[model samples]
Target: MDALMAAFVAAALAQVGDRPAWLAAILADRYRAPGLVIAMAALALLGAGLLAAAAGAVLAPRLTPEAKQLFLALALLFHGGGALFPVKAPERLDRWRIGAAATSLAGLFILAFGDGVQFVVLALAARADLPWLAAAGATLGSLAVIVPAAVLGERGWTALPLVPMRRIIGALFVVAALWLGLDALRLI
Candidate 1:
């Protein structure tokens, strides 16, 4: 349960103002199929989470608790920094040649493959022994953010202070990194 909650909160925070939400909004507008877009995106996220969680499970046994703490700290720092300075998403798929749902699944899967949330799930699962729970939680966290973006589009996302929010989240990540690193070193 702790692993589940940790993955959920971490993934949710990592996803804000991120490409998944923007991608959802774009797909919704271009395809006029919010339900399909949201559903496909969620599935894509689930796939990514499961893959990462499995990788994490593989790594967990080889890592000591201190090593896990250090890895988690590094992951937080890396993702937080990425959030604070985001890159533009790929051009929107103006034409859904393969049908809206299929296009959404492919596009989102490709795009979301390397998302911060996936890596966070990897790190969190590596910290704990519950990979499936972590994967499920990460998937839900992504849906929680992306669904609203698909539904509300610009009216919701543009209203938010994205830059400031990213920085704040980034700051939180740095703080966590510091704490974890200190603990790993037995200096805290």
Candidate 2:
């Protein structure tokens, strides 16, 4: 559906040079267990997506369509603008008493909370009234980025042109946000 695809693309673009991808690389490198790291990351993304979608669903019936559109536009604008900045690498959770698996799961889940991708998922879910579908798309999109980063490790991941990708996506999101905001206001 339109909601699913939109969330997928938005999440994928938002994550290009974001903290999650870098965190995935750091976890993979530290554990040398890329599979576990990837799986844990996937679970974390799924959890975050579900929470976002739930919040979106809760707001859908309460807000007018125009209000929802405006909210979505704002979310997109915030995400896009944030994507323009370079993300510093996140610290590894070495202090956790849990083993690597638990640490990864908790760390990734915590990192994903309130992330730009999740905000996009929340907006799309509310706008489309398709909470589960939007969440699924977002989770998959996040995996698409983190899987590669996990497999490649830190050095290989750094080799990718993430900065350029982030800036380009950020600019595109900003443009889309402006257009959508105008439409929501019936200004164009």
Candidate 3:
């Protein structure tokens, strides 16, 4: 329980004004239906976190220390490598065919895949042996910030000052990725 709470607090603090905000800003810029977009994004994040948590819970008891270290090292390597080369910007949401819901889901999947927050939350959840609680906490923490940002983003680009925020968040993500990578490698 203490571990869960600590992981939750750490994950929550790490998420604020970073990846979630950036995701919200991107969705707002690309999509028309903010509410639907937010919902879809929330669902996608929830799904990913749940999946990660399940994996963590199932594997926790079996993993040797060396195996655990190796897994963490690999995760850090992949995440850090990804931070170095971001994906191309997603196409603007098509408002008619797929509508806002699908677009939101797609956007969420894309963003969550690249998000340091998601990785950190999953790693902590896995390490702490409380996948479900960690997943729930991470999902909630992500949405708590993202939904508001989407709402504000819908108002206008100026409503959130998204451009500068994006840059700041991007930089933070790189730093986090590097730190996590180094920590995993026992090089920090």
Candidate 4:
């Protein structure tokens, strides 16, 4: 239980601190509807977290240590490669008209889909023992990171230095992925 809780906390913090906040801020600014955008983003994250928890509950026990290690390693490699060689940023939201709500939602969904932090949280939650607690913690932690970013974004982009923060979080993810991989391999 202790180990599971620790893993949950560690994973939650890592996910919360990662690049999603920066993306959320950018999205909020682009959409010019920080409140709605933030809420939708939070809903997407929450839904993903719930799915992860469900998966964890169903799959964690069946996974062998080797399989877990392999999964972690693959996840790390995939996510790290993505961060190291990021794709071009998406085009700005079309917020010029009032009928852009559907477009905005679609854009938010796409943004959340590309959010590595959301994926990390889901993966970690899927590995956690207390899936409910892990999911709740991750969901709340994500909101903690995102709400602030959205607020700051609404105020102004200059209100925060997101670039350095993103690098820091990315480094943390690399370290975490390596750590999980090592543990899964029984090398830790």
The candidate that achieves the highest lDDT relative to the unseen native structure: 2
Ranking by lDDT: 2, 1, 3, 4
- Error of model 1, residue 180, in angstroms: 1.0
Give all candidate RMSDs, comma-separated. Answer: 1.5, 1.0, 4.6, 4.0
Write candidate 4's Cα lDDT for 1-188 as tens digits: 43245434544444443455555676677667778767776676666666666766676778875775566565555555455443344455545354334544555556555555445544555566666665566556666677777777734543555445545655665776788777777898
TM-score of each: 0.93, 0.96, 0.62, 0.69
Candidate 1, residue 10: the lDDT equals 85
lDDT of 2 by residue, 1-188 (tens): 87888888888888898888888888899899999999999899999999999999998999899998999999999999998888877877767789878988989998899588888888899988568888899888888999999999989998999999899999999999999999999999
Q: How accurate locally is residue 95 in candidate 2, as Cα lDDT from 0 to 100? A: 75
Give the Å error, residue 123, model 4.
2.7
The C-alpha stretches of model 4 lying farther than 4 A from their native spots are 1-23, 30-32, 85-87, 95-105
lDDT of 1 by residue, 29-82 (tens): 777788889999989988988899899999999999999888888888888877
Q: Could you tell which candidate, 2 or 3, scores higher by TM-score?
A: 2
Q: Which ten residues in a row have the lowest lDDT in candidate 1?
A: 86-95
Clashing pairs in 3: none
Question: Given candidate 3, what's the lDDT at residue 175?
Answer: 65
lDDT of each: 0.83, 0.89, 0.61, 0.59
